[model samples]
Target: MRLSVAVCVPLALANWLLFSLSTMWADLEPRDLQFQSPLAWLALWANLLGIALLLAVLWRFGLEILEALAAAIKQLFAREVDWPAWFAELYAGLRPLPLFTLPAAALWGAWLVLFYFFDHPGGYATDVAFQIAAHALGACVYLPIFYRWRVLTKASSHDPQISG
Candidate 1:
């Protein structure tokens, strides 16, 4: 989890910063824009690659990160928590739908709305800002569900009664 967070956060931030720089450059005259230079193009490709890497990291380690977070939270509140009761409740609340389905669908809907309906004067900066906002929103929604799923899965695995 520490590894996942260490990697994903920096990659996401780098992508955002690169897109911001590119957007700013788009405002300059074509002849003056540095983003047209080969180095800038390399940066642009790097940003794309960073995004892919970030997605891959999340796919590979997202659950592990969430599990670590849950464990930390549980440890932090150990004196106050009722472990058995908590696990019972979590298991009771388990749903048939996959954990990520709702959040992913909502994110997709948000992207569609932003792409088709939002007014942004057709500037690169606006597009970058929208992408950033979408990603932030996705993280906000995804993390909680991830944590919940992780906790439930871990609990069931540790206690065979929960699975039964």
Candidate 2:
């Protein structure tokens, strides 16, 4: 599950990049990225490089998060701490990270869709397409929130207290 979450971020990013490249975006065309005076292909390459680096960093972090969770579970089993308090603390620790992710994903997704809209054929159809992506973005960004909620409240009463 953790692996999948980490993989999905890059997959989504690549999908956005491909969408941009296939369109009149900074790729396969020089219109959007042509604002600078020195206007070089470097601008486009830099943007692509940034995306690649972001994806790699996020992927690695995701794996590390999984590893941390595994370690936490082991600690719980070993009676090093009360499972509930530790679980709650771990959840709290991870809280800020997920909140950051949701906003970042939403903002980036909005930026991508806005770029798409700028190049798309304007009409009711274009509006509809843009709206659909917006909905998807909202849904995707809420994933972490939902997962946390489930862990805290719904999923198997996941209190970390080790049963004696």
Candidate 3:
């Protein structure tokens, strides 16, 4: 699980960088130039490969990764933790979709509004900063719901009769 996260995060960041570069190039380059550029093609393929790998890791080992993260976070604030009881209480009556979607929508809406009001033609650093900020915002919106869903899935998997 730790290995999966260590690999997945770097791949995710690389994908983001490639995606940002490709989009920025598209905006800045002529159509002919874009079509003829090897760097553009390389970036595209790299981004796709990174995405595929990241998704594969997440699909296979995501539950364990989230569980590990949850455990670590729990350890931070408490000396003694009851794993079963904590998870039971945490996931009790949980509805992940609304929890994820509502906050995500609100956050994205606010981000868009901020971009509209504050966007300017800046250099690479500024664009990268904006991209990082956007990804961080998305992470904030998705991580908790993802953790919840993963824990629920893990719990359900342990009991054959139960379904999530």
Candidate 4:
């Protein structure tokens, strides 16, 4: 789906940018650094929210791909004269879901927390590891939710009476 490609590519780039910057910052900072308070908790919540938003987009992207495949099959079976036109129509119908902000916010938040939240001399590695583990957990939690949303969206799209 164009929408997915458009949104995800930029997000991936941004993530890389932030990750690099964070690594640089971490390297430059004094070895002895830690958050004055429990800023990791804020990072945790932001990461969770980002995961939720990305899962929603991923669900929509999967559904759009499935719909396009189905449409292509139907068109092929019918021997449609203008397949490109049909595809263009389908692409147009695949409206972009509104979730461009979540990934950015999440990445920035996580970067800040990871690169800025260490006080002890030997805590940086542990904190970074914790961030990684938290993101992994978030992904695990989001998978099922994405699947459920995809199924629901597919069902609702099929029923013509359901509007918006």
Each prediction's Cα lDDT score?
0.55, 0.53, 0.54, 0.50
Q: Candidate 2, residues 139-163: lDDT per residue as tens digits?
A: 6534654454445443334443433
The TM-score leader among the candidates is 3
lDDT tens readout by residue for model 3, 1-164: 34424434544555465445556455564544454467867766777776778677776886667567766765664324356744554445232433444444454444444443355345566557666765775575456655664565566557644442
What is the number of residue pairs that collide in model 3? Answer: 0
Residue pairs with clashing backbones, model 1: none
lDDT of 3: 0.54
Error of 2 at 115 (Å): 7.9
| lDDT of candidate 1 at residue 115, scale 0 to 100 | 46
The most accurate candidate by lDDT is 1
lDDT per residue for candidate 4 within 36-132, as digits (tens), equals 3356545644665675576567656766755667466545543322444334434444432324334534554565455544433346676676567
Which scores higher on lDDT, 3 or 4? 3
Higher-TM-score candidate of 1 and 3? 3
Whichever of 3 and 4 has more TM-score, that candidate is 3
Show model 2 residue runs off by greater than 4 Å: 1-38, 63-119, 123-164
Q: Per lDDT, what order, best first?
A: 1, 3, 2, 4
- Stretches of candidate 1 off by over 4 Å are 1-35, 79-118, 121-164
The local distance difference test score of model 4 is 0.50
